[model samples]
Target: MPEGSLYRMAAADINAAVVFEKVSKSFGSHVVLNEVSLLIPKGAIMVMLGPSGTGKSVLLRCLVGLIKPDSGRILVFNEDLTRLDDQRSADRHKLFALRRRFGMLFQDGALFDDMSVGDNVAFPMRQHTKMSEPEIRARVAENLERVGLPGTERKMVSELSGGMRKRAAFARAIALRPDIVLCDEPSSGLDPVMSATLDDLILELHRTLGMTFIVISHDTAEARAIATHIGLLYQGKLQVFGEAHTVLQSSHAHVRQFFERNTQGPIKVL
Candidate 1:
């Protein structure tokens, strides 16, 4: 079956958490995403794999309403994100409401250096909700505990090691109990053991919270361990996407080349 047809069939399911319909984006003459269509089901751990400039990050940004696509529609929980314009007040409100359902863990942790760990986790709740100080404190503790950073609330961001900082960022990501969590290179900058630990943490969080996770990563081992669904983007197109096992076993040239780590295939080294 064609990729578009497969995606359309999957998108027809009512349990889809996100649907990208022929989404395309361009930067001047350079095309980024070329009519990428996909369906991420609710509660799925989807790992998106690609080379550095294959538009994986662009797709994530489009999903979160940060960067608008030049064409096509993105549906989150049946609501069309492409239709919501931030320039208009009513649409801006809708966009904000839509964004509240998502939690983003940016690359480099993106934590405030000056703030305490607890304050960093509580920041979203304080901004988006009217929770009391006591309530915020309790929730912060709970999230910290969930991410295995318990009792480090007063620690400054600079005090934490690389792994600890990632955990702290993860703690903040789930602070609001979002329905979808977006992780950009969750295993980056960590040693092998720490990367595996983070992958385990992602699984634990998904199992416990039942949130859909969309992860952008280059770690093939991480994908093999945690991904329920897998996508490979190359040269601005989705070369392959499906169940993790199926994609891993794919005979497609791009998929095989990527999984096998071959130096020669359809994917040219640029």
Candidate 2:
């Protein structure tokens, strides 16, 4: 099916995995996100596109509760987020449990250079689980194999190439086998071939794991290849959003010019 039709069908369905409503955020005097709202469906790849500092990253952080919104609500699986409190407080335990539902692949991989590949992958399980040392080691190896990084358990983070580091980070992200994976700039810093390979790997994970994906990136080519849906963020606002191909075909000058890489369009050059 065409990508546009696929996105429309998904959006019309009532069972969205993640929903944002009238969300806004700011840093001091500068507004970062202005009443931004979007829905990312379950088991779908929703790529966020924007120029640098346009709140794409900010939006992701908001979704994970790393950054709170100044106003509006964030709902994951239809639960109010701002009400989340400590595990001991009322139904707050349920909200805290939701934290485990996501695995995030941050920009730059964020691997600890002091740790070995296996330890890096094992970090999350260590923090979140009571699993014994042996069990954690076993899980680490399994995750590494899952990411096609098997047998590199003792490898130091600094010794790996940029692509390898990204893969290792992916292994770490999936170690907990969460229901959603949030990736930031997943294809950045890699050559075209490596980027395509990364895209294929991400698609494979989506197909096999059935995990929801929220990818924040500016790479239009990568977005076209993997995004089931797309949203455009500009000037701290959600300028356009829909299925990937449909939104890209937008006649809105800002959308058209940004995607086409036209310098003379509505997106003011910095």
Candidate 3:
């Protein structure tokens, strides 16, 4: 059997919420992901760690069908995303439906400055669902409360503190009750206490909702706090991947260098 066929067979686990089979991508001559295959179990909080420009965010974008891989397959709930081209009218609905399963919190909050907090959280529902204004309002209030920002609905986005903005963004991300939440550097630009607080919010949401979470971060502390599964990508390859504790204990030079913050290891500054 061909090597690609073997990867497809291995990626066909029914228990997996997402799978990447021999996926690769390149921008011009710059290779971002090189045959990276991974299986993310249903409801697992998988934290992807890597140095800057190692394709951590690229992998996440591929999972959501925003960027198609150059080769291989990406499966979400057993449906292959690479086969569906969103730019093609025939595949748009299928692609949109597949994307609805995911909620993405961008590196920056990405909230609209002109919108009120309530309106921001209501945006997705208004765009995606047929819920009435009253119903959307109720759901908006509930999501804000879940993110510990209850009753701040009327405030402008400018009125929120940095941490509050992130929390508000979290509320919007979960507003539609997506099955998978993708957090891109949730703790970036925050004080340690605020970062910890965000981490706690993640834990609380995962515990209560039982949704799958894939977090992209440079923070080992965040991974230690919330990752059930962990993966480290370097130089366009996955260096280590397994349960959080197992990967933490890995003897891989790249993994150790990252977690230990050693400057003299295999990972060179770029």
Candidate 4:
């Protein structure tokens, strides 16, 4: 059976892929996230959108334990990552185990310039698994093909087009067949056509992989195209969150200003 099919089979047993209860994070005196609460269902495509520096990426990073919150609870795969202390042997073990359940696609592809595309895709597996080299190679090829990058395994990261680089990073992200995928600014620098294409690829992955997706982005079009759920963050707080249609219909001034892309609202043009 396919990995997605397996996830679908297990979906009914899982309550939520991720849950946040009054989560907050701060850097010294500057708050980045404030009492944000959310529940992300399994297999749902949830987009976290906001202006730059509004803590969109911070939310995703928190989900994967890359950023620890100062207070409140965040549950990813039932593990309280915020509570895990790497100082303890057992907690450190638990942290790594929980993190493995998630795959992340960072901005700018973040591919190793020296590694071949195939090797980049294979890197995660090599780091985390004991699979034979041939098996690892086969899985790398399959994931690359899934991202529509077939036959480019030997190509260097420098040799790829911008859009292709994005796809290649995606291939690397899914190499571990994680239960959830987190994307940071997946549409950052692409043209409309390529951005839409990337959106389609994301949709395909969610549909076929049966994994929950949390994307940090600012593109309204991409969110409208791909999100089943939407969360709007501003000034380090989640101003609104709900089903796509509900979020779109929100009457909040901040929400209105954001959707309208206007310079006249709460988001000051500095």
Candidate 5:
């Protein structure tokens, strides 16, 4: 089956792929995310950009329910995520059901080196579905081909190059064909060519399949190429959020300098 079919089967009914309302998270006295509020429209590629330690990844984790906010509300697919405390909750099953609607592509590939590429890609389906071995085999092949990594099924993850590994992980991420694909630095460690390729792939997926992509990347080149919208986070708050060109052309000193990559700006030099 084509990957688009899988995505259609997994797309959520909620109009917004993700909604954060006054969300705050802290590690003791250190506040990482403060009142971060945004609504990511369905099928849009929204890139969150900022310097290191600006909590971009933390917010991504929060979006995926990996980290709970200390306060405020997160509604994924219109379900109050905070209420998924346990199986006893009335909508717990439904909330968990939404889990399949999204997938994550980690910064480091995050693939198990011990497993072959095919096995790695098949991991989620194996864990979540009752599909037979042959069915999984076909699905993995289809996903690998979609990411331009056909016949990589038996290759060990360690054998792949940085770009290949990223692509492989991307293949795995989309194997389940999630409607919402949260990518944390998808092109972090790759060369310019590879990064561009990755960005192009994301754009293709977005346009062809209407996948909602939430990318957390400091790679300006990558972000500029693929993001339909942009959000800039600084000092535990969103400094700006809007359409790509508008936010990129903001008069805000911080936003300007950040995009320009100049030494002098509102970004305090430590």
Candidate 6:
């Protein structure tokens, strides 16, 4: 809470986990996002759904500063990230500190193939904390076990199956015990049974850790199973945003058509 700062501020009592205000982004001739705004409450799982190239992933990247928006503001816990100018020494430090609070699980898991499964999980703890090797090892084991991959520290990452790899990535994402976790397409490229299993793991983690989760996903069933809130993005704009049941049961033909994977809907086929 700075004295009289222009940083976008949420109410002290609102307890919003993340807020985006009139955010817009474009790449050359293509507009990826247009005045997108949404609120993610703490301890809630918000599933963002859209077709490919609809800018759901871009929206996540913007929050973590991977891609800067062309305009507008993004706030985490009332701290305006968009206002944190990296050219200033103090602001740069603040930006780094703010980012360290986020844990991200990439779409493909993005584990280092050369690193052992245990070492991969320990990577964040090693870089971010002064924890001893023994402590790091213990945390790695604990996280692996929690993801239902118990005692997998000695195994090579290349040896694990696709589902195992995703779960391992989830383990690494939580290694820092972050305030919020960002997951991009958690169920992508997995069989239906494995996807269901992964969805169960997501629900379990949310229940136990109570961390705010914003997940970008195409799987309607997975989103319905795990989301406390659901948002739909279409053509550089948000079409709908609401609680899971309300959004899922939407009378909007596009919403209903999307969930049903219908070819005849408002969403244009590329």
Which candidate number would show the highest lDDT if scored against the true structure? 1
Question: How do the residues 1-270 of candidate 3 rate in per-residue lDDT, one tens digit apiece?
Answer: 125565577567777888888899999999999988888888999999999989999998888877889997988988889998777987888889889999999988999999999999999999999999999999999999998899999999999999999999999999888999999999999999999999999999999998899999999999999999999999998878889989888898888899999998989997
- TM-score, per-candidate, Cα-based: 0.96, 0.91, 0.96, 0.93, 0.92, 0.95
Clashing residue pairs in all predictions, respectively, total 0, 0, 0, 0, 0, 0
Write the residue-wise lDDT of candidate 6 on 1-270 in tens digits: 121122244423267888887789999989999888777888889999999999999999999988899998888888888988898999999988888889999988999999999999999999989999999999999999999999999899999999999999999999999989999999999999999988888888888988889999998998888999999999998888878988888897768988988999899999
Instruction: Please give the CA lDDT of all the candidate structures.
Output: 0.92, 0.84, 0.91, 0.86, 0.84, 0.89
Task: State the local distance difference test value for candidate 1.
Answer: 0.92
Candidate 2 lDDT score at position 189 = 94
Residue 72's lDDT in candidate 5: 75
Show the colliding residue pairs in model 3: none
Q: Per-residue CA lDDT of candidate 2, range 149-170, in tens? A: 8899999999999999999999
Report the candidate with higher TM-score, 5 versus 6: 6
lDDT ranking from best candidate downward: 1, 3, 6, 4, 2, 5
lDDT of 4 by residue, 31-54 (tens): 998888777788889999888888
Off by over 4 Å in 4: 1-13
In the order shown, the candidates' Cα RMSDs to the true structure are 1.5, 4.2, 1.9, 6.0, 6.6, 3.7
Q: By summed lDDT, which 10 consecutive residues of candidate 1 come out lowest?
A: 1-10
Hey, what RMSD does candidate 4 come out at?
6.0
Segments of candidate 6 deviating more than 4 angstroms: 1-13
Candidate 1 structure quality by residue, lDDT tens digits, 210-241: 99999999889999999999999988888888
The collision pairs in model 6 are none
